[model samples]
Target: MRRLMSIVAILAVCGVIVSSVSLQHHYATSKTEYCDLGETFNCDIVNRSEYSSILGIPVALIGMLGYAAVAGLATVYRERRDTPALLLGGALAGFAFALYLTYIEGRVLGAWCILCLSSLALITSITPLSFVVWVRSRD
Candidate 1:
């Protein structure tokens, strides 16, 4: 269980880093070479879009907070029996939100941000790992 939690913590940290990069992209004024991968996959278009923020707060910031919460649960609260459930629940919620953003990028924005996709992958991986941890803890 400890090893599994450690893995979750590491994945969450990666998520934070990815979200930080996306947040930076969200605020950048000028385009960068790495952010633009032609018209189909442009981080600038997705990051600068009106959908990037919610209630004046950047979504990337929310991702950072969410990942931090997961990390904290996996580390500080690992001894607690309820930590498994908490971690699983948090990962599930994060994954769902990431899916919604992916929908927006594909249907509304028509552009995909690599950072956002990276975050999604991180969260997707975390969700199943968390579920496995939770199940193992139950036995």
Candidate 2:
């Protein structure tokens, strides 16, 4: 179970890293057609929107750091039992943030970024798995 949880966490981390990098690329680019699939789906519109950043930092960069922290916590959980709790907490926070971003994309921006949706999916999956891992560790 522990191995499975670790593998899942690692995979989620990879997904987040890929999505974050792609989002960062889109954010840095001026071309709006990179991920513009249609009227409802457009990465450029979402990434370039005012909601894409928090204060002065890009949200994708924050996601990369958050996912990296989750990965690190999962990797070190074996040596430190309390790391599972931290991993679960981090995953939960990331999941919550992803939800907020999704809401912004849907309600405010009226556009969707594939990379952002993928990161949301990854974080959604990570949250449950992290919870399970933390619960099992407590047993």
Candidate 3:
């Protein structure tokens, strides 16, 4: 079970890394049509919106750091079982933030970024896996 959890965590980390990198690229280039699939789905519109940043820092960058921290904590969890609490907490926080971003994309921007949605999925998956890890660790 521990091995399985580690593998799941690693896969989640990779998924988040890929999504974060893609978002970062979108943020840097400001190429709206890069991931624009249609009128309702546009990466450029969402990434360039005012909600894309917080207090001067790009949200994508913050996501990258958060994912990286989760990865690091997962890696160390093998040595410290109690680390699952931190992992679960971090995953929950990321999940909440992702939900907020989704809301902003749907309600405010009226557009969707593929990369952001992908990150949301990754973090959403991580939350449950981390919860399981935390539960198993308590045993």
Top-TM-score candidate index: 1
Give the alpha carbon lDDT tens digit for every residue of 1-139 in model 2: 6685677667667866766666566557466565789968988888888887799788888888888888777765555868878878888899999999999999998999888888888888888888888888888
Instruction: Please provide TM-scores, in order, for all candidate models, with all chains considered together.
Output: 0.97, 0.89, 0.88
lDDT of the candidates, in the order given? 0.94, 0.80, 0.80
Runs with alpha carbons beyond 4 Å of true place in candidate 3: 30-34
Q: Could you list the CA RMSD of all candidates, in the order they appear?
A: 0.8, 1.8, 1.9
Candidate 3 lDDT (Cα, whole model)?
A: 0.80
lDDT of 1 by residue, 1-139 (tens): 8998999999999999999999988888889778699988999999999999999999999999999999999999999989999999999999999999999999999998899999999999999999999999999
> Which 10 residues in a row give candidate 1 its minimum summed lDDT?
26-35
Candidate 3 worst ten-residue window by lDDT: 25-34
**TM-score of candidate 1 on Cα atoms, chains taken together:** 0.97
Query: What lDDT score is found at residue 88 in candidate 3?
Result: 85
Distance from true location, Cα of 35 in model 2, Å: 1.8
- Candidate 1 vs candidate 3: the TM-score winner is 1
